[model samples]
Target: MAMRDASTQTEATGPLVQFARFDNGKLRLFSAHTHELRYFAISHVWGDIGWRKIPGIDGEFLVSAQKVDFIVNQLPDLVGDTPFWMDTLTVDQRNQAEVIATVQNIPAIFRDAGKTIAVRENDGFYACCADAIRDARSIEEFRNQMFEHCEIHKDHVQEETYLKRLWTLQEILLSDTVQFVAIRGGNMDPIRPFSRMISTIHPLEVLGASFFENISFDCVLVFSKAYVMQEVILRLPAPLRTRRDSIYNDLFPMVHAASNRRASKPRDYIFATMPQFPWYHYPKNAERMEFGDIFLDYWEQASKNGFLSACKMKASMIEPQVRRDLGKSWLPSEIQPEPACLGDFLKLLGGQLPGKSAHTGTNIHVTRPVCISPFEYDHPSDIIEFIARMTQRSHFRFCLSCSTGEIPKDQGLKNIPWENNLKDINMLDWLQDVLGQNQSVLPFDSQAGNEIFSNDMRSQGASQANHFHPDELEVARDYLYTIFFYKNANPTEDNAWWPGVRDSLCRLFEIAPASHRLLPILLLMTATICCGMPVSATAWLMRFFIPIHVQFGEISHIGLLARHENLQGHPTPRTMLCVGQHLPVAPLLAGEGLHETFFPIPRRHDPKRNVCFGQELVLIDPEDRAPIGLLPDILHADMDEHELWTNIKILYDEIAEDGIRIVPLSDL
Candidate 1:
């Protein structure tokens, strides 16, 4: 039996594809389009370094002598004379144009094939293991025998030869039916489905955990890649032949799996996974394109989920400056993007992706932002206290978004009764009382720490404050989970949330007297504000800061950073644009009159104004008379009840004296 290259017509028609079968003891090769013929596709590790010319009747086909011998001697019996397609003979790799055109179609070839049989050339370890487990009585006995065989064959390969290559993922995943075969005792053992071989691993993992110690550990589980490939393939929704569109949703997981696998060519890493995406097409000039450019191009065209997922991937070198120049400051530069793990991949799929979408060639327009004047601070502690106080204020607003059963229909801020003097009510204590005692307040299981935190926050022990009640402990625990776990979507990145807070607390405590008690409470309040409800748009809005450098100019850029991400340094006055809004809790207020009308108030347009718990008012500079900032048109509960009416009167007077001018700020 002999093989030949695909015909010129076949290469030109679509993807370079050919099928071979033994007719009357002679191997014959014929050309055909995808899905036009019923063929068994062969996926195998190429036995040679690079493509070599194999002499044939009409032209030289791309296949090595080693692979040719295996196909002619073994493939015929494996597929039982059903015409088969393998990359070596099917692809005319000698032609560069044909290689590019057919690279993507390889997956479809395997996918559309009647069956796929992976040939493990020159591998006898699987045969020994199969024979060892054949006569076993129980799963435990089978597991021990397998481990014993592995111990004996320590020098032999620990993993299947076929599964070692990076390109096998696509070959295994896309195929409808797949089985592993090799030269077992000069003839093939009964061909086992890929799943059947994978099934042997669970007994050892589940029931024979201790059996690993008895044998050379690496040898005991010979086909670990099989387990990994099984997991990767199983993640895909079934019936991929009919529903190729479903693969888009599982793009990140496939990418994550691909990162573990490797290809000889750098571009093959991206090309191998391209088939999973039906919408994406490999660039015509893909051979010349850098890996990063190709990667960005692929993800940019991906579904919204995939595009965002790529942005979050961990990379050694990220081009923030390049991204900024590209007008997509939100996206990182040239990353060798890799998701941390399978769990992280699923988290991106299930959890909320990064918010405040700033795409390429777009202005970051920040609407209704509050601007303030620069103030001199003697110490960094002042900044911590400043940030902590602002965090508390933000938390107060965050509570407005949450609704609970305890609050009456008339009440605006539910469950917790916030008083008129907002300064007196501690936001953390309120959250502790509401969420801890009333377990049913949130939709998710509040008590289940593992459900939320991959790293259990409850294990962090008591809060920094020494004397805290059990309920306070519980709140602190859940609060840490809400903050650290959710904020750092990529687990590999440093958990920057607590360290930043700890440093701030340390600086603040150096000056303040009662530092012991204040640390935990302030920390809780900070986390509450930074990561409000994981899914809330209001929570999303809170993370953004409109940087006002000189403290007296039109806002240009709005920066959004995850609190848990490592902070290079403290955001100086130039970067810290403190903007906030008041919660409209007027409906919940026991009494109403002039307060019922939620309108903007007129205060002395003072310079160097800090964020305060005031009603609808965008503080402006009276002396400069500059258009300072914008605020949401809503009433806050903290202002003095009488002061509210006085501001209203002053607002009317100011309106008459100086007609309010609406000036638009330049686009960011």
Candidate 2:
């Protein structure tokens, strides 16, 4: 066969390779710039890098020998003598300019092809599924058959290397029609209409049930689902494809879909995603841009468009080393954005307006430093220790005052009566009150009528019968007291509930604390609050005691704080506090108020320095009333901390008329 390449006039008129018949039964290629040519495009994984000579009409050309042999042998059984353009043969790999030019025209190439054939070597499981689906009458019956026979071939499908290549995503997406050819035993097993298989095999259905009892099968299910979603999203119209309401919403699934896929170059990970992001512009010198520079540009663009409005100055918890290596303070090398529930916290603080806007290119300004605290902790463990000491001291006093004895017996603590005479007798409301007055309480009806003795059953839809039994209240109250008073017992040793409570505390801190560090902190914080310390003071201690310096367009200091202690670290916590602005909302909700963001604070090698980048909490100046806007400064190691503190004290003194008192650390 002789092949021709289309001329490079434009992407539409760009070169297409044509294959022609040859007397010697070898392929020959020639360049042609015409719209009338019809060809199928082959999409396959490059299994081996080694090259071998493939016979052409004029001569022989070096190509991935294994890939060429596999495709040539399978072609007759797969597509049946249809001429096609395989990238390996069509694109000159040795010519850099040709590769770049051809890559830019890839979308057009795939879209113009008559059909896209995805070639994969058949493994036992895929073969079995294909065989079973041919005879099955319904999806449910097919699923049943798959479940029965899947175990034998499950490993092959889960570990399929073909699905884990990045370029294959674009190839699969751009094609109008795709057919799968599973090659096995010199025979091509045709899986017609690729979308049909995707629609039938749902990851949740296959992986959710533990019927398989295999971890690898579960993994396969997850990856397959991601692959399906990635392809489906790409097939949507361009306008609907990448235009998302928020960056957080769009970036997660996009990154997740491509997570396990390998790219030849690290920058290709970001570049491949560009086709999906219509709004994003590649740098004019994209070919020369460093991988880190690409990420930095992405962060800048996202910030200018208001994507980083809610981002706090926390270092990457999982990939701290990656962030450090990138040497960009504003960009997180790890792509996981803060969760959406953080926005709920912003609403509570009256910080952000509800709903997303297409145009949120607000100019955020970080103003002068308010108060930089002299107080600093060396590690999260140090803060945990401080909380534990405070808790133990408070618990000892409570136990000493108990009427039963110096320390209340377990039975006595369990028997503590619910004060029925209280004016507000609603169990839910009372529980909220006990937890913290700042905590939001779900309404009785909102709690599925869990209220044991509420006469108000109107919200229950005329069903007083559905109310909880009156006896349940006594049990509920006893359980609540046990949890509340468990602080007096030695929490570190033998308490079952303490571990759960500690895990909750670790979550509250946002950053993952070292192992065995959080339980004591939770116990202590609870004990101190129960011992009559103001909830606000305890909250400030946990959230706003440590200062974090943030830089994006400008450098500024922000303090981490939470409004409600009880709900502080719930996975989707109600709110997070930005002390610099005195803003309390979820981390995701900080977009409007947050102007300057900082990442990768100077790395602290000395444990005794008591300086950490992503600490859980920080202290905010009580009187720093700087208007919310962007500020300018780069936080360097040599920066004057003394001057920063001086500015903070000035701000504190200026608000003397407001009667706000700065609580000293020693007082706590």
Candidate 3:
């Protein structure tokens, strides 16, 4: 597509060609909290470095109140005589002022248009370009969008001066080439996880916060020559700017703060606005407090989620320039500024994802499917599920969002509960208990109102689980399905739900998978009535599926690590000595399954110094401990793998030998 400038009269009146541009090495373009779209130092070269119309994904920088303050602080000391301030587009987008000026020079485009040119201004100037634009939508549309743009950023970018200033920044600070710090899973020093959302990662956000505690940068800001007199794109009411030259008034750092310091150019600039306060804001020496385990603090549960590569960051860089040249391009910016609206949030949530949501009927107070005896929840997802199935005729299902560490491993079978806590747990035990007498609880709920399924309803020849006791039903429910838990070599950086722990849900509940793309359908109903297709459903589709749906709010469950993912890499699948995440994490033909891996943490003496391969699963129960071997045919090790297996085998042998010597029935 050919690019267009402001001066070019639209042969066919429509949107102008103000392309999105990027100069900084950034992962994504983000609208700044300030009026101007903020640009960040992407810090790396990228391949797909360009722009797209997508919101939030377009830019790298965020003009927080701080960055804005910092920029103003860097301005030269002479403020009164400064004609005007120009914030130029730094990326290659609008570096060609001549091109912008030529295109913007539309003398006859507007019926009353005189001339349009790029210019900058200082505080002494008149009613200025209170707003800017890369392209004019409609004269009216352009003006309105500029209003909302100004409202959100509190500063404008589409102004000619803004583009000019940005261009200056590129000439001064930015380089055509820079190096990006790379991320490799285990190879990068000590591999640790990162977590967020729960405010557990404040220390990580302060990558350089403390570096500024006792020290400041010896700084210099290179400025470009100023220009004057060009018609401003948008106008505002009394309090806002009034003339073209007045636009420059925005250059000096003046903040709407408690102190309200109106410094056009301060001797030593600090910040425009403060960030969200951390848990520890101030204390005697908190600035010097030790950062205990950075990895543990910021670790996201292991999942190989997706992200834009370095090149993509580069592509997104072009956006700011587009915004700068186009000057407040949005027709109705006030309509959508952020993710406060559901659709807006979903837009940022990527695409039509496959998800599930819980049904109000999937209630805690509701009775459970009765369970038969001699059985227990065999795995983490089973405890309450057994109860939910008693009155039902189909296999139930549920979804959960959790960490890799939350899935359970069977040591020797007494139905060991994984790390999932009771508050984080939900079960169908009540239904199972009620059905224990081999009688239907449906009879008691005569007022359930719905006669068809409410009664002891079933197909004539169907084999219902009614014959089973609550305990037996419990065992069947637990064993029928098992989870497959594996760790991601790299964690998902885009999702906020990770770094989570275990949460088990009925497979049919449909609530948890609300994010998944699956939709509830009329066909799901037909099948349930005719062919009996297990009534398979997720948490999301269930609520609306029921008529006159009553909302039961939501069950609050503790977000825990779902399961420990072993991302290091797994050998090609073969039946040699592999441990799959299931009821029996690793079986031994009824032999032995180890408990956990323990190392000599004390550097040969400190028990704490030992890591479990630094993992917990390496340790095995004394009864289940035994050295198992993998066939050589399916094995391919590049020395590192061999050494790992060898060390693991040694631990297994030693633990087995020692455990057998002292393990008791209670230990199992």
Give the Cα lDDT of each candidate. 0.39, 0.36, 0.20
For candidate 3, write residues 278-307 as lDDT tens digits: 111112232222211111111110011111
Q: Order of all candidates by lDDT, from best down to worst? A: 1, 2, 3
- Per-model TM values vs. the true structure: 0.44, 0.42, 0.17
Candidate 1 vs candidate 3, lDDT winner: 1
Identify the runs in model 3 with alpha carbons over 4 angstroms from their true place: 1-420, 423-482, 485-668
In terms of lDDT, model 3 sits at 0.20
- Taking the tens digit of each residue's C-alpha lDDT, what string does model 1 give over 1-668? 12234534433344546777777666678877765777888887764544454433235555656665665566667777688887666666677777777776886687677777766654434555666766665545656676686667654423344444556756766664556565434322234222223223432232112112223333234323333222211222244432224333433332232122336665565677665555567888877665545666665655343333323321211222232233343333243222222222222222112222324321111213333322222243443444433333343333332211011122111121112312222332212222123220112222332322323322331122122333433332333333332333234676566455546445534544333233334333343233222211211212211112122233221122322122223333322222122221211121222212232333432111211223223322222221122222122334455745543332222332332222211111
Candidate 2 residue 202 Cα shift, in angstroms, is 7.0
Candidate 2, 461-490: lDDT as tens digits? 212221222433333333323444554356
* Ranking, TM-score, top scorer first: 1, 2, 3
**lDDT winner among the candidates?**
1
Which stretches of candidate 1 lie above 4 Å from their native place?
A: 1-16, 23-27, 50-65, 79-81, 122-124, 135-144, 184-237, 241-259, 304-307, 313-326, 332-668
lDDT (Cα) of model 2: 0.36
Please report how far candidate 1 places residue 317 from its true position, in Å: 7.7
Please give the lDDT score at residue 628 for candidate 2.
17
